[model samples]
Target: MAVSKKRDKNVYKAPRNIGKPESENPKWLIPTALTMLIVGVVWIVIYYITQANYPLPIANWNIVVGFVFLGTGMVLLTRWK
Candidate 1:
């Protein structure tokens, strides 16, 4: 008696598309904005709490950094469609 060999059934197929199209809604916008806002608020609070032990220049720098995050979040929200 003779037996036939079985062919391999496992094979990989290439994707038709390389990347996601721009037409899809970017769902990350809202969550990212919220994160930025929360981070900014936390920075401001930390700066205020430590201001008593730090120099004026350092405190000012922290305030500026916090505002930058808030501003960036606002800008991103505005651009959302």
Candidate 2:
């Protein structure tokens, strides 16, 4: 058998950037998002577990806080890519 020596006709250029740009994402972004999501769930669970008057002693506002954290985490997750 003989080996071929022809080169592929593609322009070869070395990558100029050392690493990914900041616009891509940070190492902590996903973790932070996950934390927010988990914390949000825990916060809501505590509120419910305590009858919504043991943790913060506030009524009806517990749901709002949980939703806000969850929403923020979801938004952050969307920006991860």
Candidate 2 regions exceeding 4 Å error are: 1-24
As for candidate 1, its clashing pairs are none
TM-score of each model, in listed order: 0.59, 0.67
List of clashing residue pairs for candidate 2 = none
Q: Evaluated with TM-score, which candidate comes out highest?
A: 2
Total backbone collisions for each predicted model? 0, 0
lDDT of 1 by residue, 1-81 (tens): 899989778877778775656475489988998889888888888778876343245647878888888998998888676
List the lowest-lDDT window of 10 residues for candidate 2. Answer: 16-25
lDDT of 2 by residue, 2-81 (tens): 99899988978888875666576889999999999998899899998988785576688888889889999999999876
Model 1, position 11, has a per-residue lDDT of 72
